[model samples]
Target chain A: MNRSALVSQAEPRDFIALLKPRVMSLVVFTALTGIVIAPGGVHPVLAAISLLCIAVGAGASGALNMWYDADIDALMGRTATRPIPAGRVTPGEALAFGLVLSVLSVLVLGLVANWLAAGLLAFTIFFYAVIYTMWLKRWTPQNIVIGGAAGAFPPMIGWAAVTGSVSLESLVLFLIIFIWTPPHFWALALIKSEDYARAGVPMLPVACGEAETRRQILLYTLVLAPVGMAPWFLGFAGLTYGVVAAAGGLGMIWLAIEIYRRREGAAARKASGRMFAFSILYLFALFAVLLVEQGILARIL
Target chain B: MAEQPTEAGIVLTPEEKRRQRQRNIAIALALAGLCVIFWIVTMVKGAAILQRPM
Candidate 1:
């Protein structure tokens, strides 16, 4: 069958799927947390606008990624059902959709929020779409290590939307996600190494072997443990945040250790799956604690 | 006149046509909502809106 002929007419739902709503939700949550924890004020409406722009920009990046990666996505079992690869949307259509959303998001953010926030949003789109997707993803095993910066930018952009400037506090938030990404992704890579290998993408486990990838996941988690607690230690957060960070950091390290110790068969896959699932909760709990301390609890007390 | 078919020669059934209409309406509504938002924001910012450093 002719590949182009396989493409069906795209529906609105297909376009929505192209946006990768699950990934966009994570971006929105973390970015909203950044806004809540920042040590300044923005009008409620403006804050909402900033969040909307961030979410759209993240979606735009996802769409562009899907368009460019349609080939590999078709090959990989995990991504084969995605809109472009599933023949529900054409790559040209995805490209146009992403590009339009990218421009609209940046322009709207700049008009409603400060240009600094808008610029960060723009750079984030470029970093994810071009730098990570186009260049690093296929080229190196360290792709997630460096490309993690794209995901890390959202909080900083959110903080800038509120304060009109980047601060040490926002950078701490950035560093937390940046450091957390490697372990989070490597755990999944350990399980999906075959998918990545089939797609010709040099994920850590595929490129460097599972044993080395597991070791790297442990090392990154060790570093993340201290860095994740840095905000609480530095007094940017309260005692409640401090406790949650300590507990979550310990949980993350334990999971990483489990992944390292159980290195074969179904046990290893189970360990990696547990680590990946817990990593999401770990990051979410850290930010949720901060949001409560700085946004809600601060207001109440 | 015969109904025009898509380039793929797939003619839309009535249900598909209804869905396409709904999608177009949704897109229009979303665009209208965005314009309304921008207008409200501009009003709120007022003279200070132009003072933004690009």
Candidate 2:
């Protein structure tokens, strides 16, 4: 073996890429909303630290996921350019990085915030790394349906950080994300069914067929629309939030209907693509509204 | 004397060396940030930082 070939050529950016920053950003945003919305406020510094810990923990999960999924990632066009699959970072290096960050983030969160948050963070990492990536991903078509719980946890963890316990409100936040995941992912799956089929991953579109996937997308969206508005109706938010949620929920439903109605040609692909794109906006707008509303209320009262 | 190879008996190329340096710097910065956070939290907690909640 050539010693020269054994030396890593990975850059620091590759390490960052391993963390899945885009996913981390969403986690941070949702978690931050959780922190801000809790009744009694946290110290600004502590809150910042908690957010940091959550973000790093989420990143750690991402790294661990990439480390384990490298082979399948290499096969899928969507994931082919990931750090490990792209040959920028080794799986061993990614695993080490993930493990180190996971421990550090959890410990720091426990020390700076509360143990509940830390415990949730730890479980979130374990779920994403072990349950979802290692076990569920290749085994079932319903992989993301259950794996979405890992993503749903941040806001609850954030709420726990502030209140030192879980509550109904936090669980509602969790429910919204959990329901939203199926439609959001299935729309993308509808488009990239071939990539998933190639990777031997049993996403709904690959395993259950496109018609079933589209029907499921519509079903989940119907559920998500009402759940997305629960925060407003539940009294944590004001009229603006209610209005935005209602509008976004309608938009999501409309797009989902389009996805269900249009079933072939570029029109079908376009419907799926539009649904995929709009789902992101729908979720982002929902969280952003909650964050803004709660932020202003927190400041005023 | 020639440049020494690492304990693994592999010589790092110039690009590898540069990246290693970059990673080391990032690690140092991260450590420093953690220290600052710990210190600030200690000050905020004011001698009761150890009384953690379950």
Candidate 3:
């Protein structure tokens, strides 16, 4: 993370760094799932390109976000080492890079798949960079709540790539991510309240007391659990998806309760961290289970 | 102790403004290239689809 260490390399990884590879990977996986699970088939080459664009677009959004938040990022311990904050990339450079990539991703996906998918992808980058980061982030406790919709678009975009329109299945995928974001992020916010506080970001835990935040998390999970099962209930997904989603929901609730119960100490903090980490795993699993059931396991199970 | 010396809205230096302009131009150009490519691909795909027998 040291700037000097990264600076001397003759070859710069600057372009690759912009994409937020960790986030891109998840976006790729979910988007791919959307393509495969949707009704019609996309040509393999086109599918590859579409997914590539989605990844690039997601990265572009991340870069733009980093550009805007560079000052705040440097202040927060967790974000201080990002390329923009570390001075590896300038804010203008990052913004330009992101803007270029965002345009490319949307166009490529539109060309390779459908304009609808590309249009959605373009809107997603806009929502994330302009709306979420530029407008909503510093202004509201609902930052992640509303901003969550932007991240939730990948699977929908992927589904659109195949079907060329939105459907019940895609919406369900959107709902899972939408509902998951608050609790998932709130868990981290609970732990990193100091980082957000220092940055003057009005995250939920900082705005409302810990108890109220915990209540909000639990309430969101209560809604999320039911929404997660909706695909199965609506007949877009199989029973296995229902069962797994139900289990994951309960598991998430259990951790949320533990977080609420143990709010004051190292153990409570660790519990929140545990939930934050597990929530990620839970989402991936929930999607993976949906894919398996709808595509492969539907026949056997 | 390590916060940026300037506040969030500090005016960009001349060098920074120049960099920003260049970046803006580059982004605009890249976006144009993407549009060109997207159109070409879609046209090719559409032609192929139309050629196919129903």
Candidate 4:
């Protein structure tokens, strides 16, 4: 590359892509649910600020992940088009962008919400960037298992923002996502074993073989089925959430069974892919149900 | 003066300049948004904004 081409030619959209907007959306949705479901409410403007800070914090972690994982990301077809890997943005720029946003998000969250929420946000950024991306991802197959806590913290942080403290209900929300992560991610890992191997990522299927990965997915799904319905059973949520959670739990189990049974050729890939897609819908439906119940239905009734 | 040379004596192409201008505008908008947020928070909290929880 010539020295003249070294000057950054990245567009604004490239900066947005660096934030992993899709993942940020999920974090914001789940965090918003936490805020809505909590006992007391926050000022509307303050709530918006809290959500913005949490979204930015999640985005910052994603940038740092992309910066650190650029090498391996380039090797994988799925992640190869990310800003740093695609050569639209340089690693130093991404790192600086991530660090700046991380600090600002934490600081602003503390000002608008509470230090507890801000502290959780900061820990989540550190856990994802330093612990999961830098260390656990390459070092162990259980990377997503532990690293999933980072994703789970958004709802807890949201709850903290509203109530200014953590509670059992918030921890239950955290647990649901934490337990759901293994089956959710391992399903995709099963389908992308070759890609994982190529990138040297040591994902479950690459490390433990497809048979064990499928078994682990089934085990985790079995656990998730019960945990997913806990909000209904524990009395925090109403009948609508119970029905949606029960149905989603059953769907997760059935899909896991299909993935476990079909272990040959395209059949295996299709089954894993179905599980991967359904897991996203299942989790989204659960949170969406909870959000509507607590946010709207509760108000009306 | 289509291509402006920086301190390193490296000149940016027209596309680079356009992108740089876009980035600069984005930064300006973001800073302005931050200021607005802070001001709104102050108004919402009134004198109570300074009394934060430990």
lDDT of each: 0.90, 0.92, 0.82, 0.92
The candidates' interface RMSDs, in order, read 4.3, 3.2, 9.6, 2.8
* Model 2 docking tier (incorrect/acceptable/medium/high): medium
Q: Tens digits of per-residue lDDT for model 2 on A25-141? A: 999999999999888978998999999999999999999999999999999889999988887788889999999999999999999999999999999999999999999999999
Off by over 4 Å in 2: A2-5, B1-8
lDDT of 3 by residue, A42-133 (tens): 67766777888888899999989888888899999999988877776767767877888788787667657778998899899999999999
User: Judged by TM-score, which candidate is best?
Assistant: 4
TM-score of chain B of each: 0.71, 0.76, 0.65, 0.81
Clashes of 4: 0
Please state how well chain A of candidate 2 matches the true chain A, as a TM-score. Answer: 0.97
lDDT of 2: 0.92
- When 1 and 4 are scored with DockQ, the better candidate is 4
- Alpha-carbon shift of residue A250 in model 4 (angstroms): 0.5
How many pairs collide in each candidate, listed in order?
A: 0, 0, 0, 0
TM-score against native, each model: 0.94, 0.96, 0.83, 0.97
User: Predicted candidate 3: what Cα RMSD to the true structure?
Assistant: 7.4
**What tens-digit string does per-residue lDDT give for candidate 4 at A1-301?**
5443468868889989999999999999999999989888789999999999999999999999999999999999889999888888999889999999999999999999989999999999999999999999999999999999999999999999999999999999999999999999999888778888999999988988989999999999999998999999999988999999999999999999999999999998999999999999998999999999887689778
Candidate 1 error regions (>4 Å) = A1-8, B1-10
- Better-scoring candidate (TM-score), 3 or 4: 4
Residue B34, model 4: lDDT of 96
Model 1 steric clash pairs: none
Give the TM-score (vs. native) of candidate 3. 0.83
